[model samples]
Structures are given as structure tokens and as C-alpha cells.
Target: MSHLLDNLTVHPDCRHFRGDLPCRPNKTHGYVCESCPVYAPVTSRVLIIKLGAIGDVIRTTPLLRRLRQERPGCFITWLTHTPAILPQAEVDEILKFDFASALQLQARQFDVVINLDKEKEACALLNTISAKEKFGYALRPHDGVAWPQNQLAEHKFLTGLFDQVSQANTMPYVQEIFELCGFDFRGEEYVFDTHEDKGFNWNQLPSSGPRIGLNTGCGDRWTTRLWSDEKWISLITQLQQAGYSPVLLGGEAEDARNRVLHATTGAAYLGTFPLPQFINLMHQMDAIVTQVTMAMHISIALRKPTILMNNIFNSHEFDLYGRGQIVGPNRECVCFYRGTCQLGTSCMEDLPAEKVLQAVAATLPAATILR
Candidate 1:
């Protein structure tokens, strides 16, 4: 038994190696670590700590492409609250935020640790992690609040705190994150796996016209971003009149309202789905119409042409990848980043349906235009 134990060897640095079980090559072809021809070793391990609000997670995927270019032989582990939305193939391991996962992470060490989220928990995790190099936010030792780890993160940190600085800032969210990690954002496209959904078939959707997905909710947290129901009905009617297929999209929060929109405008409403299936559903559309929500980020990641309705947030913060338009209200928004409308009425009310309709026609490919 001692002799046998002495002869055993393992390669933890191999990307295919699973610490708890047999590696893929060994399981599939009985390839031992000593003589495995397909062995791929990684030079370093990296951890990405982005916790929640799924939209930010989707947008953060662009950093993966940059990371790969800079460090071709690095293995990545992502700690996220919404692990289901992340591309498993792109990342070596996706960890959901729970007590067990936190304990597991605490025991392990990484070559590089990056935390883009400023949440107290995220900063605390960054502080606890053992890494050769650390970037982005960290928990301040005295106050127990989030603080920038380095100078690069200061710009993004300040922008979030001050409305004027955010409004005057020309850097898009992607560029800011890239700079935070000491890389230039050269229009690196989002890395998303569109083939994750296996259950749904979208054959029933109209085959003639270009499918337009109208993501109709801004979420409960941001009531200031909601558009009037009357405006959505008008836009759907106009799309049908122009020989376009209008489909409503949302999560459980927006389902009842979406059903109402479908009934009122005779538009297609293919109910809410899991995150992966929701991404797949968005992939079927040629273009999308949405406010500043998860759907907007998903649409951008899927590379669909989009017309983004805006009012509360800074328009400059969004990078549409030159494939979409950001249409703000005619009346300037008084509530910049506030959740509730300070003016008693949302500025989205001033954004007319005809304007959004024109944006839709302008955004889609010329061949898809029916009128």
C-alpha cells in the first residue's frame, strides 16, 4: 500500500483535471496523468468575483476575452450569484454564492483575484482571498466598507458615487471595467454561450417578418424606468401594421403585464423562462426594444440590434457596440439614478411610441424592412 501510494501522481494545473474526480481524458479514454497525450496545463489561476444583478454579469463577460488574450494559459473560476447565466465552457469553474462555496474558496488560492462588484460581501471576499495579485475593490480595514484596491479602480468608484462625475464621464461600462483590470477596451465583444437552452423550440414564431422582442419591464427596483402601457400598445400596433412580428419578453416580475400587453396589442408573448432559455429566446429576435434592464445586456451580448429606451441613467455609460440606438426621452430626466420618480411622473411618458417605432425601423437590417 505504501509503494502504490508512492507511485501515484496528479496534475492539478491541467485545465481538464477535476480535483474531486477523474479527469475527462481518464474517464473517456482511460488516459493516465503520466502518459496523457491531450494534457493541457495552465500557467496560473484567476478568480472573478461579480455577485448579482444579472445584467452586470452579462456585460462583464467581455473581460474574459481580454483575459484570454493576455494570459492564454490561465484557468478561470467565477464566483457569481447568478451562476446559471455564465458560460460554463468559457470558465473552468462557476461557483454560486453560498456558505459552502465561500468556505471552499477561502481554502483555495489564486494567482490573480479581481472583484468588480462594490458590494460589502464582494469586497469582504476579495479581502479574504489569497492571491499573488489583486485588482478592483476591496473592503476597507477600518470601516468595513468597499474601497478601491488601486488607482485604476478610482474612476469607476467615483462615477458610481457622484451623479455629476458619472454624467460627465465618457467611458462606457466595458471600458471602465477593462481599465480597472489594467487592459484597454478595444471593442472586445461580449463572450456569451447562446446554445445553452436545450428544451425550447421557437418554430411557432412568425417566419415572414423580422422578430422584434419588446422587453417590457424595468424591474421593481427601478420604477423610474417604466414606460406607460399605452406606449407599448401603440408601438406593437405600429410594428404589426408595418409587417413586423412583435414579441413581448420579460421575467416572472413582468409576466402578468406582458400577458396584458399581448392581449391588448395582439402581439406574441411567449411567457417567462429560466435565464439560459431567456437568452435563447432573445437570440431568435432580429432586434430588441428595452429599458436599462437585464434584457438590454442580453440583447447586446447576443449581438442583436436594439433600441434602448432611456431616462434615469446616464446614456454615455452604455456601450451598444455600434449595433444599436439609445433613445432618451424628450423631457430631460429629473431623477438621474433614483429608483422612484422625484417629479411624480416618469420622463418615459414624454417618449412617444412613434419615435421608438422609427428607431426600430432604423436599427434593423434594410432587407428586414417591410415598408
Candidate 2:
């Protein structure tokens, strides 16, 4: 009986141990926990809850680097809406924001839980999560309002509350998140899984000259950041005249407008694609020019030379990783984080195509001088 019981003993602490089914090591090598040569015990269990926009999820990946450096062999579980964007190699498990995922998370305990989002639902979830230590925002039980969980999170909380404080702030988004989690930002680069080997072929795109991607729309949510059609035409003409191949890029939201732009300027518009394919397509570009949208984050992650057009938000909030430049209008924008322009006329109009051309020229490689 004792020998039979010994055979049934399982090592739950082992990193390769999975309760549901046979682990990879056991399946591959037929090694029991006692005799496994590559056995690795988990040091810590960490949970990150960041159910925000897709762009926010992409930018938040830098924190994973800090976590791995500080706590080696830690098992990390991340909860986000954009699970496809998270790198599977970095995260032990990726949970989407849904009732079932929430229930599973609430049932488990973690050594540390960090909620990077400030939405009421996210804060409320953090309140119910079982963790020895918690960071970032949490819901106030008394008033049911979100508040900073610690001193480090206070700055981010305040910035979200007031536009003046946010505009005056100079801390980059990466540094702010690191400080919130009691870690110093060491210029860790984003961990984006480009899925390059997924059989994507971009042979038809112009190969000789620098292929410049012109992301057309800023999304419908932030129409205040939209550049005029005439400006896009001007920029495309200028780029073509300067010997750079201009390619228009956007999602379904900008498909119609991109077609119009392509027709007007004779630039290349390959149509929009799903997220994964779009990422791989953007990878082929030599440089990117986009407004403050998801493309900007993708470009940053891919480390492509980017010219980021800005108007509403503080330019300091972005960290381009030394590979990009943020260009704003000549005049100050009256809209600060507002979806619509307060002046009834957008400041994006003030951002001339010539200025954007200059920024692109400065950001691209020196060899990209006219064909």
C-alpha cells in the first residue's frame, strides 16, 4: 500500500507540474517528478491584470521584463482582453476578461497581484483577488471608487484625474508603470511576438527604396487627431517625389479613406488585414508615420523608425525607445485628451505635410536620400 501511494504522489510545486494533464517534460522524457533532471520549482506566483485597450496591453508588456529579472522562475498569469498580443513564452497563462476567467483567478492565490488598469471593473476584480501583496489601483469598499493602492501609484492616479497635472507631467508611461510596481525602469524594450514564421509573404511591396508606411486614420474614437485628406495627399506626393515608396496602412475603419487616398495620390494601399497579419505587414516597412493610435504602439514595439503625430495628449507620456520622434502642430492644441476639437477647427490642420515630411526625413536612415 505504501509503494502504491508513493507512485501516486505528485509534485505540485514543480514548474513542469500541471494538475490537469501530463506536463511537457513527463510527456516527452517519461520522467517522474523524483527523477526529472530539468525539474524547476516555482519561486513566486505573480498575476497581472491589465484589461485595457489593445495598445495599452502592448505597451504594458515591458513590465514583464522587470518581473522576470527581480523574481527568477516566477510563474506569471496575465489577464487582458487582447490575449493574442501577449507573448505566450513570457506568460505562464493568459486569461481573457470574462466571467469564467475571473472565477478561476479568484479561486487561486498568488504571491503578488498587480492591476495596471483603473477601470471600475478592473479595480473591483483586484479587490476580490487573493494575493499576499497587491499593487496598482484598487476599489474603495466604502465609496466603490477606484483609488491608488500604494504611494507609487499615486502619481498615475492623480494624472488620470486632472488634465493640468497630466499635461505638466514628464514621466514616460514605462517609468510610471515600473514605479507603480516598486521597480525602477531600466529602459527595458517591449516583448512583442511578431509571429514572423506564420507563413506571411510580402514580396510584392517595393524593395529598393525605403518603404514608408503612412497610417491613415487615428480611429473614430479620437477624431480630434485626424489629419486632413489634403494633407495626406500632399505628404504622399512629397514622399513619392523624394524617391521614397509610400504605402498606406490602416484597419477596416480607415479602409474607405485609405482607398480614396490611394486613388488620389497613386500610393500603394494593400487593404487592411487582421491584427496578426497587420503586424507582420508593418514589420516589412522601413519606417512608419502614424497618429496617436494602435499603429504607433506596434511601430514602437517593432522598433521601427516612426514619426508620431500628436495633438491632444502630453508628448512625454510616450516612450519611443530612442527609435522614433513625436511631431506636433506648430500651435498648441486646445484639446487635451478630448475626442473632439474644442476650437471647432482641429489643430491637426496646423500640422502641415511639409513639417511631417521634414520629420520623416530626419527619422529615416541617412541612406534613404532620394532615389
Candidate 2 vs. true structure, TM-score: 0.96
TM-scores for every candidate against the unseen true structure = 0.96, 0.96
Clashing pairs in 2: none
Model 2 per-residue lDDT tens digits across residues 137-168: 99999999999998989998999999889999
State in Å the error of residue 306, model 2.
1.2
lDDT of 1 by residue, 1-371 (tens): 36863688777779999978988899999998888898899988999999888999999999999889899989999999999889888988999999998898989989999999999988998999999989999999999988999998999999988889999999899999999999998999998988744867987676778889999998888888998889999989998888789999999998988989988987998888877888899998889999999999999999999899999888888999998899988888889888988878888999999899889888884356442
Residue 342 miss distance in model 1 (angstroms): 1.8
- Scored by CA lDDT, what does every candidate get? 0.90, 0.90
lDDT of candidate 1 at residue 153, scale 0 to 100 = 96
Shift in Å, residue 108, candidate 1? 2.2
lDDT for position 38 in model 1:
88
